[model samples]
Target: MKKTNLSFIKPLAFAIATVGLMAGCGSDDSNSSSSAATSTVVDSEDNQLAFDATAYTTVNISLDGVTMAVRQYRIVYVANPIEMASQSAFGSTMLLDDPYIYQTMIVSVAEASVSDENTALYFKVNNAGWFTSAVATDITEGAEFVSTSDTDAVGAALKAGYVFIDVGTRSRGARAVDGSWAGKAPAPVVDAKAAIRYLRLNDALMPGSAERIVVTGTSGGGGLTAAVSASGNSADYLPFLAAVGAAGVTGEDDSLASTINDDVFAAVAYCPINNLGNADAGYEWQYNGIRSDDNTGSLNGVAYSAGVQPAASAAIAALFPDYLNSLNLTLDDSSALTDATMNSAIVEQLKEELERQLAAGTDVPDYGEDFSVTLRGTTYAIANDWLTLSGSGTSATVADIDFEKFLKFVTTPIALKTVVAFDAVGVTGNPNISGETNLFGSDSYEYANFTQWSWNNNEVLGDGSGTDDTGLAWSDYLASTSELATQLKLINPIAYLNTDADSAPYWYVRHGMIDRDTAYAMQLTLYYAIKNDKSVRDVSFKMPYLTPHSGNYDVQEAFSWIKTKLDAGI
Candidate 1:
């Protein structure tokens, strides 16, 4: 998808206008000492590498008679010089290099204010691998990515003395690629903190010009914000280097917590996927509806399962090669099984051997009778069971339970097992134990809590068993669906706000009660959760009726709310 190019006034013009508004609003009380206190920029090469100097342009947006020379920093992909220049010529031939291999831009707003004065700093990070230039590309054919509503919201924020910062970090569209998240936390998090640090180090770009700041994002960007805020530790260079596979910086230790001018005062998230490790129960029903559109269960009535399965399998298979290489196993030796197909077979054989070893009270020898005995008991046993029940057919059936079990066993134990092993060997860190730990625990089964309006309430959404009886059974199963929950959670702003509340920065959350994307129901759930949480005092939620996800009503309402917040310094 291609994003529409939005041409707004030049940065210099916006900045001059902003300054004029500030000047007219009140006297510039920027004391020399106050300026000096916040003016120091750390002279570190890594910091420099993370900063995009060229992306900085002056904007002069008029606000309430003040024309401020706002420094507008944009995070854009700095495509490889060779590849960029040859785009038209080399199109498909260009290396599919990672989109995150570029610097980030952070805009800081500086203004003078009294002790009781309220100044707001706005930080906006794009979701996933999206770049500023690729905003239009992120939208679907009928969907708007950054709608006019979004632009108006930003404009209103500025007029209210809110210094808006855009962290043109990596875009979210890149997640569509295969193996993007294999063996790593998404790359956008690193970019997020870098953007935050840049803003802290340079406060001259803000309007209210106070150290207080708020963070906000939607979808994958919301997840990134939540992760950073929830983690609650300062950003350390070593961890950042480890995450991005960059060379470690020596003798430089900066914590992200301290680098923030102050704690993130508040956070606002829009449909954030808080936990990717587990599927969401509420989303499964919606997904099942999508899947049931055709006789054969599939996304968009297409055979997407095949594409999805292989990519996942391939990612799991990658772990074997990585582990073998780490163990110094040669390709020609026993490790030659590292080939995905061969590796899968070897994994099956190993499982059999291990089971035999466990049964025999001794370690099973290589490729021998004991191994075969176990293999026959396991693999053949399943194949035989399928044969006994129903003769082989094209459709999967209950008689194929043994076959399904065997496949799942091999996939999870071998393929998934290797991923866990690699993570242990590579990252060498304990699992994070903090807020909402184990929300998606292994024992947490999912069930769909269907609303009264679901289409599938009377008919099965897909080819799955069970009549479309709108009872607890169906509702439970649908609520337990993970795929829909994954997508919905990705867009839930309330989830982001909850994650951000841990940080000190305040964020304003606005949701349309009737939005289908970020379901009105889900928004209410999150709102109550935040309102009830004792830890989150700075966050606020606003619900407007007669609005969808990206409608004019939502935009205008959000703009008004942002204006009120910035003006009140709440």
Candidate 2:
């Protein structure tokens, strides 16, 4: 609920306007801002970097019978472009999975001047299962065109002069022919930061201000979005940036090139499946005793085994309380998060979500009827009698929510993931081989244990038969226990909160209430951490009722939130 700094916006906007006017009037022809646009710099010994102000295609974007012309620029942001270029060699024969892995696209409304307060930058990094690279396509290929009677979020932003930048980055399975990992921990985030720096160094040629970039994504991409937002300008990324030969890797403080050192203005995350180090424990803590089965793969509603899984799950669940206590997170009133108040906080959040759904006139089955809601043509159902609504449509509030009953109704009948969800020790019969396992791997194909609990107790945690280690030994895991811990800290957003890193000032996080991908504890932890940070200007956290693990469900509303911030010049 932190308010935007209206007092700080006016002068900043005036200054930007004045700068733009001066640039347009040829008042500062010799200024570094003007010179940087046309100048070239050596990114490495072999490649030189420059931004062509005139190199772009004008595309007519039509949404809701309204069309707007925007210029789109597709540029390779890496220093050694040929290394990751199209059909480039990875491992002898394995070609580059995504041709545009090192590229970026900037779309902005056609304008006379480059600098404008109304034109903010939206940077999007794509990730699915942590292994699938973001598919980079031309906007002219009808990629941005979706049929809708009302304007969409991207369309609205474009019309309002917001520059949208889609960044293509390396993901979990990318590797070099030199037998080294190309896309591993720190690579994706490093690529994203490099893209930001590329835009900043070429800010004079771009239509939006580099200082007002907003990064957004969903699921694994959402996790990366949060990482990009949290670790901005931190010294931890210096080596990685230098390795990629990113633009403006070094510069004086507050200089044009120093904008690389600046942080994003805001961030938007939906169902961010991050914080992998604590994810397993958090997942088990919520759904440990809920399911009566031992099936690790599909949610068949058949109680498989009553032996080892329940014990291992309980063991993992027991670790969550201490982890929660260790974070020292605070509630809205600044009270510490502990075992004593966790359930109450969760119940309150659920009630809030239900209240908002009621006010929106969302349809729900009768209180005595089974709980069933369809999303994206898939009807998710559960036996129910726990929720009760008061008042009529648009005025209804959550009369009561049977916490235990609701928990059973949502998670039961369907298990989102296995006991050890994120850091699945793959050796056992349990197919814990998730994308996160590849994410923490040393290379593209190798999966490693990223959590201490899973690593130490892998023998018993896997198979759920209270048996011996039947597959690959835990000691032979790729990353050592300490190394995995370090990587986890590097990717976790909570680690950067209240730290010296220039974390994004504005944040909008949405986790669907019925999302079973990751535990609600993960988002709740991030929400509380951001809410407690004094440096953050504003943070809006919400869980839409009965929504799935998706992003931009309320596209119009999300864009409106971004528009309000842009109008405020923040």
lDDT of 1 by residue, 182-248 (tens): 1112334544554454444334432344344556666445555555554332232233432322211
- Top model by TM-score, which number? 2
Runs with alpha carbons beyond 4 Å of true place in candidate 1: 1-43, 46-102, 106-118, 128-151, 171-184, 204-210, 222-238, 241-262, 285-501, 504-507, 518-525, 551-556, 563-570
- Stretches > 4 Å off in candidate 2: 1-47, 66-68, 81-118, 142-151, 251-259, 294-307, 363-366, 380-383, 391-394, 412-414, 457-482
Measured on C-alpha atoms, candidate 1 has an lDDT of 0.34
Tell me the whole-model lDDT of each prediction, alpha carbons only: 0.34, 0.63
lDDT of 2: 0.63
Question: Highest lDDT, which number?
Answer: 2
Per-residue lDDT value at 521 in model 1: 25
- Candidate 2: Cα lDDT at 63: 49
